[model samples]
Target chain A: MNSRKCLAFEIVANPAAVDALCARAETWLIEGGLGTESFPVAMLLRESLNNSMLHGSGGDPTAQIRCHLQRGRKWLKITVEDDGPGFDWATRLECRADIENCHGRGLEIYRLYADAVDFNRRGNRVSLRRRIAEVMTS
Target chain B: MTTVQVQKNDATVTLEGALTVALAQELRPQLQKAVAEGVSSVVFDLGRADVVDSSGIGLLIATHNSLKTKGGRLRVANASPEIMNLFKAMRLDRHFSVEGRQA
Candidate 1:
Protein backbone atom coordinates (compact mmCIF):
# COMPACT_ATOMS: atom_id res chain seq x y z
CA MET A 1 0.00 0.00 0.00
CA ASN A 2 2.98 2.29 0.55
CA SER A 3 5.07 2.16 -2.59
CA ARG A 4 6.55 4.97 -4.61
CA LYS A 5 4.71 3.82 -7.75
CA CYS A 6 1.58 2.50 -6.05
CA LEU A 7 -1.56 4.05 -7.60
CA ALA A 8 -5.09 3.68 -6.26
CA PHE A 9 -8.54 4.53 -7.64
CA GLU A 10 -11.72 4.80 -5.58
CA ILE A 11 -14.01 2.65 -7.70
CA VAL A 12 -17.66 3.60 -7.50
CA ALA A 13 -20.29 0.89 -7.05
CA ASN A 14 -21.14 0.97 -10.75
CA PRO A 15 -20.78 -1.78 -13.37
CA ALA A 16 -20.06 0.84 -16.05
CA ALA A 17 -16.90 1.97 -14.26
CA VAL A 18 -15.63 -1.59 -14.39
CA ASP A 19 -14.56 -1.16 -18.00
CA ALA A 20 -12.68 2.04 -17.28
CA LEU A 21 -10.94 0.46 -14.30
CA CYS A 22 -9.90 -2.47 -16.46
CA ALA A 23 -8.46 -0.22 -19.16
CA ARG A 24 -6.42 1.65 -16.55
CA ALA A 25 -5.04 -1.54 -15.03
CA GLU A 26 -4.23 -3.05 -18.42
CA THR A 27 -2.18 0.00 -19.32
CA TRP A 28 -0.17 -0.33 -16.14
CA LEU A 29 0.46 -4.01 -16.72
CA ILE A 30 1.58 -3.38 -20.27
CA GLU A 31 3.91 -0.58 -19.20
CA GLY A 32 5.23 -2.85 -16.47
CA GLY A 33 6.08 -5.39 -19.24
CA LEU A 34 3.44 -7.77 -17.99
CA GLY A 35 1.26 -7.41 -21.09
CA THR A 36 0.70 -11.12 -21.40
CA GLU A 37 -1.14 -11.08 -18.11
CA SER A 38 -3.63 -8.46 -19.23
CA PHE A 39 -6.50 -10.79 -20.18
CA PRO A 40 -6.79 -12.48 -16.79
CA VAL A 41 -6.29 -9.12 -15.17
CA ALA A 42 -9.21 -7.71 -17.11
CA MET A 43 -11.41 -10.65 -16.10
CA LEU A 44 -10.36 -10.28 -12.49
CA LEU A 45 -11.12 -6.58 -12.53
CA ARG A 46 -14.55 -7.03 -14.09
CA GLU A 47 -15.58 -9.75 -11.66
CA SER A 48 -14.54 -7.88 -8.51
CA LEU A 49 -16.00 -4.57 -9.65
CA ASN A 50 -19.34 -6.18 -10.44
CA ASN A 51 -19.34 -8.01 -7.12
CA SER A 52 -18.82 -4.76 -5.24
CA MET A 53 -21.55 -3.03 -7.22
CA LEU A 54 -24.01 -5.85 -6.67
CA HIS A 55 -23.14 -6.68 -3.06
CA GLY A 56 -22.23 -3.20 -1.83
CA SER A 57 -25.67 -1.99 -2.83
CA GLY A 58 -27.13 -4.38 -0.25
CA GLY A 59 -30.25 -4.69 -2.38
CA ASP A 60 -30.38 -0.96 -2.29
CA PRO A 61 -26.00 2.27 -4.06
CA THR A 62 -26.56 4.37 -0.96
CA ALA A 63 -23.78 2.11 0.21
CA GLN A 64 -20.47 2.55 -1.58
CA ILE A 65 -17.85 -0.11 -2.25
CA ARG A 66 -14.17 0.68 -2.07
CA CYS A 67 -11.75 -1.04 -4.43
CA HIS A 68 -8.00 -0.59 -3.98
CA LEU A 69 -5.41 -1.73 -6.51
CA GLN A 70 -1.69 -1.78 -5.81
CA ARG A 71 1.25 -2.98 -7.82
CA GLY A 72 3.82 -5.05 -5.98
CA ARG A 73 7.19 -6.03 -7.40
CA LYS A 74 5.89 -9.30 -8.83
CA TRP A 75 2.14 -9.17 -8.33
CA LEU A 76 -0.84 -6.87 -8.59
CA LYS A 77 -2.89 -6.82 -5.40
CA ILE A 78 -6.55 -5.83 -5.38
CA THR A 79 -8.75 -5.41 -2.34
CA VAL A 80 -12.52 -4.86 -2.62
CA GLU A 81 -14.47 -3.92 0.50
CA ASP A 82 -18.17 -3.33 0.99
CA ASP A 83 -19.84 -1.38 3.75
CA GLY A 84 -22.37 -4.05 4.71
CA PRO A 85 -22.82 -7.21 6.70
CA GLY A 86 -20.49 -9.79 5.17
CA PHE A 87 -21.46 -13.40 4.52
CA ASP A 88 -19.56 -16.66 4.63
CA TRP A 89 -17.12 -17.20 1.77
CA ALA A 90 -17.39 -20.99 1.90
CA THR A 91 -21.11 -21.03 1.17
CA ARG A 92 -20.67 -18.69 -1.77
CA LEU A 93 -17.83 -20.83 -3.12
CA GLU A 94 -20.08 -23.87 -3.25
CA CYS A 95 -22.68 -22.10 -5.39
CA ARG A 96 -20.25 -21.38 -8.23
CA ALA A 97 -19.97 -25.08 -9.09
CA ASP A 98 -23.69 -25.59 -9.59
CA ILE A 99 -24.63 -24.83 -13.21
CA GLU A 100 -28.18 -23.97 -12.22
CA ASN A 101 -26.89 -21.52 -9.62
CA CYS A 102 -28.18 -18.00 -9.91
CA HIS A 103 -25.48 -15.74 -8.44
CA GLY A 104 -21.93 -15.38 -7.10
CA ARG A 105 -20.10 -16.39 -10.28
CA GLY A 106 -18.22 -13.11 -10.26
CA LEU A 107 -16.16 -14.07 -7.23
CA GLU A 108 -15.64 -17.53 -8.71
CA ILE A 109 -14.17 -15.98 -11.87
CA TYR A 110 -11.90 -13.86 -9.69
CA ARG A 111 -10.58 -16.95 -7.93
CA LEU A 112 -9.76 -18.55 -11.28
CA TYR A 113 -7.72 -15.57 -12.46
CA ALA A 114 -5.90 -14.71 -9.27
CA ASP A 115 -3.08 -16.77 -7.87
CA ALA A 116 -4.32 -16.50 -4.29
CA VAL A 117 -7.60 -15.30 -2.79
CA ASP A 118 -8.46 -14.57 0.85
CA PHE A 119 -11.62 -13.43 2.57
CA ASN A 120 -11.49 -11.04 5.49
CA ARG A 121 -14.08 -10.63 8.27
CA ARG A 122 -16.68 -12.98 6.79
CA GLY A 123 -16.99 -11.57 3.26
CA ASN A 124 -17.15 -7.81 3.68
CA ARG A 125 -13.82 -7.58 1.90
CA VAL A 126 -11.57 -9.73 -0.26
CA SER A 127 -7.85 -9.61 -0.93
CA LEU A 128 -6.62 -11.02 -4.23
CA ARG A 129 -3.10 -11.18 -5.65
CA ARG A 130 -1.97 -12.54 -9.02
CA ARG A 131 1.46 -13.09 -10.45
CA ILE A 132 2.53 -10.61 -13.13
CA ALA A 133 4.16 -13.17 -15.37
CA GLU A 134 2.88 -16.46 -16.79
CA VAL A 135 4.58 -18.65 -19.34
CA MET A 136 2.68 -19.48 -22.54
CA THR A 137 2.90 -23.10 -23.61
CA SER A 138 2.21 -23.48 -27.30
CA MET B 1 -25.71 -15.47 -26.62
CA THR B 2 -26.86 -18.47 -28.63
CA THR B 3 -26.05 -18.59 -32.33
CA VAL B 4 -27.71 -21.24 -34.43
CA GLN B 5 -26.22 -21.87 -37.88
CA VAL B 6 -28.02 -24.59 -39.75
CA GLN B 7 -25.64 -26.26 -42.13
CA LYS B 8 -26.15 -28.74 -44.96
CA ASN B 9 -25.59 -31.79 -42.79
CA ASP B 10 -26.05 -30.47 -39.27
CA ALA B 11 -26.28 -27.35 -37.12
CA THR B 12 -23.46 -25.46 -35.43
CA VAL B 13 -24.04 -24.07 -31.98
CA THR B 14 -22.14 -20.80 -31.95
CA LEU B 15 -22.37 -18.63 -28.89
CA GLU B 16 -21.07 -15.08 -29.04
CA GLY B 17 -22.62 -13.29 -26.12
CA ALA B 18 -22.31 -12.87 -22.37
CA LEU B 19 -22.83 -16.25 -20.70
CA THR B 20 -23.16 -15.14 -17.14
CA VAL B 21 -25.64 -16.60 -14.67
CA ALA B 22 -28.48 -14.74 -16.34
CA LEU B 23 -27.74 -16.16 -19.77
CA ALA B 24 -26.66 -19.68 -18.86
CA GLN B 25 -30.09 -20.80 -17.75
CA GLU B 26 -31.46 -20.27 -21.25
CA LEU B 27 -28.28 -21.33 -23.01
CA ARG B 28 -27.75 -24.83 -21.58
CA PRO B 29 -30.93 -26.21 -23.11
CA GLN B 30 -30.22 -24.65 -26.47
CA LEU B 31 -26.95 -26.56 -26.72
CA GLN B 32 -28.51 -29.73 -25.44
CA LYS B 33 -31.04 -29.70 -28.26
CA ALA B 34 -28.52 -28.80 -30.97
CA VAL B 35 -27.02 -32.25 -30.86
CA ALA B 36 -30.02 -34.12 -29.61
CA GLU B 37 -30.58 -36.31 -32.66
CA GLY B 38 -28.10 -37.86 -35.10
CA VAL B 39 -26.19 -34.70 -35.96
CA SER B 40 -22.51 -34.37 -36.73
CA SER B 41 -20.78 -32.19 -34.09
CA VAL B 42 -21.64 -29.05 -32.20
CA VAL B 43 -18.83 -26.59 -32.80
CA PHE B 44 -19.03 -23.95 -30.08
CA ASP B 45 -17.83 -20.89 -31.84
CA LEU B 46 -16.59 -18.52 -29.14
CA GLY B 47 -15.03 -16.08 -31.58
CA ARG B 48 -17.10 -13.10 -30.57
CA ALA B 49 -17.92 -14.24 -27.06
CA ASP B 50 -16.59 -11.34 -25.02
CA VAL B 51 -17.39 -11.97 -21.38
CA VAL B 52 -17.69 -15.61 -20.36
CA ASP B 53 -18.09 -15.59 -16.59
CA SER B 54 -17.24 -18.75 -14.65
CA SER B 55 -20.77 -20.12 -14.56
CA GLY B 56 -21.26 -20.20 -18.31
CA ILE B 57 -17.81 -21.56 -18.93
CA GLY B 58 -18.30 -24.14 -16.20
CA LEU B 59 -21.53 -25.31 -17.76
CA LEU B 60 -19.82 -25.85 -21.09
CA ILE B 61 -16.90 -27.61 -19.45
CA ALA B 62 -19.11 -29.92 -17.48
CA THR B 63 -21.16 -30.63 -20.58
CA HIS B 64 -17.98 -31.38 -22.47
CA ASN B 65 -16.88 -33.82 -19.77
CA SER B 66 -20.24 -35.56 -19.73
CA LEU B 67 -20.53 -35.74 -23.50
CA LYS B 68 -17.15 -37.40 -23.78
CA THR B 69 -18.17 -40.08 -21.34
CA LYS B 70 -21.31 -40.82 -23.39
CA GLY B 71 -19.59 -41.34 -26.75
CA GLY B 72 -19.80 -37.73 -27.88
CA ARG B 73 -17.38 -34.83 -28.26
CA LEU B 74 -17.67 -31.03 -28.10
CA ARG B 75 -15.42 -28.83 -30.24
CA VAL B 76 -14.66 -25.20 -29.46
CA ALA B 77 -13.68 -22.99 -32.36
CA ASN B 78 -12.81 -19.33 -32.98
CA ALA B 79 -11.95 -18.13 -29.49
CA SER B 80 -10.27 -14.79 -29.16
CA PRO B 81 -6.98 -14.61 -27.33
CA GLU B 82 -8.76 -12.70 -24.59
CA ILE B 83 -11.45 -15.33 -24.19
CA MET B 84 -9.01 -18.19 -24.59
CA ASN B 85 -6.93 -16.59 -21.88
CA LEU B 86 -9.90 -17.34 -19.67
CA PHE B 87 -9.43 -21.01 -20.38
CA LYS B 88 -5.71 -20.58 -19.80
CA ALA B 89 -6.30 -18.86 -16.47
CA MET B 90 -8.37 -21.79 -15.25
CA ARG B 91 -6.05 -24.34 -16.91
CA LEU B 92 -9.04 -25.56 -18.89
CA ASP B 93 -7.42 -25.24 -22.27
CA ARG B 94 -5.82 -28.58 -21.50
CA HIS B 95 -9.26 -30.14 -21.26
CA PHE B 96 -10.68 -29.01 -24.62
CA SER B 97 -9.66 -28.42 -28.18
CA VAL B 98 -9.65 -24.67 -28.96
CA GLU B 99 -9.43 -23.57 -32.58
CA GLY B 100 -8.50 -19.91 -32.91
CA ARG B 101 -9.74 -18.29 -36.13
CA GLN B 102 -10.01 -14.90 -37.87
CA ALA B 103 -13.05 -12.68 -38.12
Candidate 2:
Protein backbone atom coordinates (compact mmCIF):
# COMPACT_ATOMS: atom_id res chain seq x y z
CA MET A 1 0.00 0.00 0.00
CA ASN A 2 1.26 3.48 -0.86
CA SER A 3 1.00 5.96 1.97
CA ARG A 4 1.50 9.53 0.81
CA LYS A 5 0.41 12.80 2.37
CA CYS A 6 0.29 16.25 0.83
CA LEU A 7 -0.22 19.78 2.07
CA ALA A 8 -0.64 23.15 0.38
CA PHE A 9 -0.83 26.60 1.86
CA GLU A 10 -0.11 30.24 1.27
CA ILE A 11 1.45 32.86 3.48
CA VAL A 12 2.32 36.52 3.34
CA ALA A 13 5.89 37.26 2.39
CA ASN A 14 7.37 37.84 5.80
CA PRO A 15 9.84 36.20 8.17
CA ALA A 16 7.34 35.37 10.88
CA ALA A 17 5.02 33.77 8.39
CA VAL A 18 7.85 31.74 6.94
CA ASP A 19 8.88 30.59 10.38
CA ALA A 20 5.37 29.55 11.29
CA LEU A 21 4.90 27.71 8.03
CA CYS A 22 8.15 25.85 8.36
CA ALA A 23 7.39 24.86 11.92
CA ARG A 24 3.96 23.64 10.90
CA ALA A 25 5.38 21.67 8.00
CA GLU A 26 8.10 20.18 10.15
CA THR A 27 5.56 18.95 12.63
CA TRP A 28 3.45 17.49 9.89
CA LEU A 29 6.39 15.65 8.37
CA ILE A 30 7.53 14.34 11.73
CA GLU A 31 4.07 13.07 12.46
CA GLY A 32 4.14 11.36 9.09
CA GLY A 33 7.31 9.46 10.17
CA LEU A 34 9.98 11.42 8.36
CA GLY A 35 12.58 10.65 11.05
CA THR A 36 16.05 11.89 9.98
CA GLU A 37 14.69 13.61 6.89
CA SER A 38 12.98 16.30 8.93
CA PHE A 39 15.94 18.62 9.43
CA PRO A 40 16.98 18.83 5.80
CA VAL A 41 13.35 19.20 4.77
CA ALA A 42 12.96 22.10 7.16
CA MET A 43 16.14 23.67 5.83
CA LEU A 44 14.91 23.33 2.25
CA LEU A 45 11.62 24.93 3.16
CA ARG A 46 13.35 27.80 4.92
CA GLU A 47 15.75 28.60 2.08
CA SER A 48 13.00 28.48 -0.53
CA LEU A 49 10.52 30.53 1.46
CA ASN A 50 13.14 33.04 2.47
CA ASN A 51 14.32 33.46 -1.08
CA SER A 52 10.76 34.08 -2.18
CA MET A 53 10.09 36.61 0.53
CA LEU A 54 13.36 38.51 0.55
CA HIS A 55 14.47 38.38 -3.09
CA GLY A 56 11.45 37.57 -5.18
CA SER A 57 8.94 39.70 -3.30
CA GLY A 58 11.43 42.34 -2.10
CA GLY A 59 10.28 41.80 1.49
CA ASP A 60 6.84 43.12 0.71
CA PRO A 61 4.74 41.79 3.56
CA THR A 62 1.59 41.94 1.44
CA ALA A 63 2.99 39.64 -1.24
CA GLN A 64 1.63 36.14 -1.18
CA ILE A 65 3.87 33.07 -1.19
CA ARG A 66 2.46 29.67 -1.98
CA CYS A 67 3.90 26.35 -0.78
CA HIS A 68 3.08 22.73 -1.46
CA LEU A 69 4.56 19.70 0.29
CA GLN A 70 4.07 16.08 -0.71
CA ARG A 71 5.45 13.28 1.43
CA GLY A 72 5.59 9.78 0.02
CA ARG A 73 7.02 6.60 1.44
CA LYS A 74 10.33 7.12 -0.32
CA TRP A 75 10.45 10.77 -1.31
CA LEU A 76 9.40 14.22 -0.28
CA LYS A 77 8.66 16.97 -2.79
CA ILE A 78 8.31 20.69 -2.16
CA THR A 79 7.26 23.58 -4.36
CA VAL A 80 7.31 27.26 -3.53
CA GLU A 81 5.94 30.04 -5.73
CA ASP A 82 6.05 33.80 -5.23
CA ASP A 83 4.16 36.59 -6.93
CA GLY A 84 6.97 38.82 -8.12
CA PRO A 85 8.98 39.56 -11.20
CA GLY A 86 11.32 36.62 -11.55
CA PHE A 87 15.01 36.87 -12.32
CA ASP A 88 17.28 35.25 -14.89
CA TRP A 89 17.54 31.96 -13.11
CA ALA A 90 19.57 30.29 -15.81
CA THR A 91 22.56 32.58 -15.32
CA ARG A 92 22.11 32.59 -11.58
CA LEU A 93 22.25 28.82 -11.48
CA GLU A 94 25.46 28.78 -13.47
CA CYS A 95 27.17 31.28 -11.18
CA ARG A 96 28.73 30.12 -7.95
CA ALA A 97 28.91 32.19 -4.81
CA ASP A 98 32.25 32.99 -3.26
CA ILE A 99 32.80 31.74 0.27
CA GLU A 100 33.36 35.23 1.61
CA ASN A 101 30.35 36.81 -0.01
CA CYS A 102 27.52 37.85 2.32
CA HIS A 103 24.73 37.00 -0.17
CA GLY A 104 23.84 34.54 -2.96
CA ARG A 105 24.13 31.32 -0.99
CA GLY A 106 20.44 30.50 -0.94
CA LEU A 107 20.58 28.51 -4.15
CA GLU A 108 23.66 26.68 -2.93
CA ILE A 109 21.79 25.53 0.14
CA TYR A 110 18.92 24.29 -1.99
CA ARG A 111 21.27 22.50 -4.34
CA LEU A 112 23.15 20.85 -1.51
CA TYR A 113 20.16 19.56 0.41
CA ALA A 114 17.67 18.73 -2.30
CA ASP A 115 18.36 15.69 -4.48
CA ALA A 116 16.73 17.45 -7.42
CA VAL A 117 15.87 21.10 -7.96
CA ASP A 118 14.15 22.92 -10.83
CA PHE A 119 13.00 26.46 -11.40
CA ASN A 120 10.10 27.63 -13.52
CA ARG A 121 10.92 29.65 -16.64
CA ARG A 122 9.85 32.82 -14.83
CA GLY A 123 12.19 31.93 -11.91
CA ASN A 124 9.54 32.71 -9.32
CA ARG A 125 8.67 29.08 -8.65
CA VAL A 126 10.94 26.29 -7.40
CA SER A 127 10.28 22.58 -7.02
CA LEU A 128 12.66 20.18 -5.34
CA ARG A 129 12.71 16.60 -4.14
CA ARG A 130 14.66 14.60 -1.60
CA ARG A 131 14.78 10.86 -1.11
CA ILE A 132 13.37 10.20 2.31
CA ALA A 133 15.67 8.36 4.68
CA GLU A 134 14.55 5.01 5.92
CA VAL A 135 12.40 5.15 9.02
CA MET A 136 13.08 2.54 11.70
CA THR A 137 10.47 -0.06 12.29
CA SER A 138 9.94 -2.22 15.32
CA MET B 1 17.22 37.90 20.77
CA THR B 2 20.93 38.11 21.62
CA THR B 3 23.11 38.84 24.62
CA VAL B 4 26.69 40.06 24.47
CA GLN B 5 29.42 39.74 27.02
CA VAL B 6 32.64 41.57 26.48
CA GLN B 7 36.00 41.28 28.13
CA LYS B 8 38.57 43.69 26.80
CA ASN B 9 39.02 42.69 23.13
CA ASP B 10 37.00 39.50 23.19
CA ALA B 11 33.23 39.23 22.94
CA THR B 12 30.76 36.39 23.29
CA VAL B 13 27.43 36.73 21.56
CA THR B 14 24.67 34.33 22.62
CA LEU B 15 21.80 33.93 20.22
CA GLU B 16 18.43 32.32 20.83
CA GLY B 17 15.93 30.79 18.41
CA ALA B 18 16.28 30.62 14.64
CA LEU B 19 18.94 32.72 12.92
CA THR B 20 16.93 33.45 9.82
CA VAL B 21 16.98 36.55 7.65
CA ALA B 22 15.02 38.61 10.12
CA LEU B 23 17.27 37.81 13.05
CA ALA B 24 20.32 38.33 10.89
CA GLN B 25 19.02 41.78 9.90
CA GLU B 26 18.24 42.67 13.48
CA LEU B 27 21.58 41.42 14.78
CA ARG B 28 23.81 42.93 12.14
CA PRO B 29 24.15 46.29 13.88
CA GLN B 30 25.01 44.79 17.23
CA LEU B 31 27.65 42.59 15.65
CA GLN B 32 29.05 45.52 13.71
CA LYS B 33 29.20 47.49 16.94
CA ALA B 34 31.32 44.77 18.46
CA VAL B 35 33.70 44.92 15.54
CA ALA B 36 33.75 48.68 15.68
CA GLU B 37 34.61 48.54 19.36
CA GLY B 38 37.72 46.55 18.49
CA VAL B 39 36.54 43.22 19.76
CA SER B 40 39.12 41.04 18.10
CA SER B 41 37.85 37.61 19.07
CA VAL B 42 34.14 36.84 18.90
CA VAL B 43 32.49 33.57 19.85
CA PHE B 44 28.94 32.84 18.75
CA ASP B 45 27.06 30.63 21.19
CA LEU B 46 24.30 29.01 19.16
CA GLY B 47 23.32 26.44 21.76
CA ARG B 48 19.77 27.70 21.72
CA ALA B 49 19.46 28.25 18.01
CA ASP B 50 17.82 25.43 16.10
CA VAL B 51 17.72 26.85 12.57
CA VAL B 52 19.97 28.97 10.35
CA ASP B 53 19.20 30.06 6.81
CA SER B 54 21.48 31.41 4.10
CA SER B 55 21.13 34.93 5.40
CA GLY B 56 22.32 33.74 8.77
CA ILE B 57 25.27 32.01 7.16
CA GLY B 58 26.03 35.22 5.25
CA LEU B 59 25.98 37.21 8.47
CA LEU B 60 28.55 34.87 9.98
CA ILE B 61 30.79 35.09 6.94
CA ALA B 62 30.53 38.88 6.92
CA THR B 63 31.34 38.99 10.61
CA HIS B 64 34.33 36.77 10.05
CA ASN B 65 35.55 39.09 7.33
CA SER B 66 35.11 42.10 9.54
CA LEU B 67 37.15 40.52 12.30
CA LYS B 68 39.82 39.22 9.93
CA THR B 69 40.67 42.75 8.92
CA LYS B 70 41.39 43.52 12.55
CA GLY B 71 43.45 40.35 12.99
CA GLY B 72 40.54 38.96 14.99
CA ARG B 73 38.64 35.70 14.62
CA LEU B 74 35.14 34.29 14.98
CA ARG B 75 34.33 30.95 16.64
CA VAL B 76 31.00 29.18 16.67
CA ALA B 77 30.35 26.93 19.66
CA ASN B 78 27.69 24.39 20.63
CA ALA B 79 26.00 24.16 17.25
CA SER B 80 23.45 21.44 16.82
CA PRO B 81 24.36 18.53 14.54
CA GLU B 82 22.22 19.82 11.69
CA ILE B 83 23.74 23.26 11.81
CA MET B 84 27.20 21.77 12.05
CA ASN B 85 26.49 19.71 8.95
CA LEU B 86 25.50 22.87 7.13
CA PHE B 87 28.70 24.64 8.08
CA LYS B 88 30.81 21.70 7.08
CA ALA B 89 28.93 21.23 3.83
CA MET B 90 29.59 24.87 2.91
CA ARG B 91 33.26 24.38 3.81
CA LEU B 92 32.90 27.16 6.37
CA ASP B 93 34.87 25.07 8.85
CA ARG B 94 37.95 25.86 6.81
CA HIS B 95 37.44 29.58 7.33
CA PHE B 96 36.76 29.56 11.04
CA SER B 97 36.12 27.32 14.02
CA VAL B 98 32.75 25.55 14.38
CA GLU B 99 31.99 23.12 17.20
CA GLY B 100 29.04 20.81 17.50
CA ARG B 101 27.23 20.26 20.76
CA GLN B 102 28.61 17.50 22.97
CA ALA B 103 26.60 14.35 23.23
Worst 10 residues of 1 chain B by lDDT: B33-42
TM-scores of the models, in the order given: 0.62, 0.94
Question: Which residues of candidate 1, in runs, are more than 4 Å off?
Answer: A1-4, A61-63, A90-111, A133-138, B1-44, B49-51, B55-76, B88-99
Candidate No. with top DockQ? 2
DockQ of each: 0.17, 0.85
In candidate 2, position B50 carries an lDDT of 86
Candidate 2 displacement at residue A59 in angstroms: 2.9
In candidate 2 chain A, what residue range of length 10 has the lowest lDDT sum?
A: A1-10
Q: Show model 2 residue runs off by greater than 4 Å.
A: A1-4, A134-138
User: Which of the numbered candidates is closest to the native, going by highest lDDT?
Assistant: 2
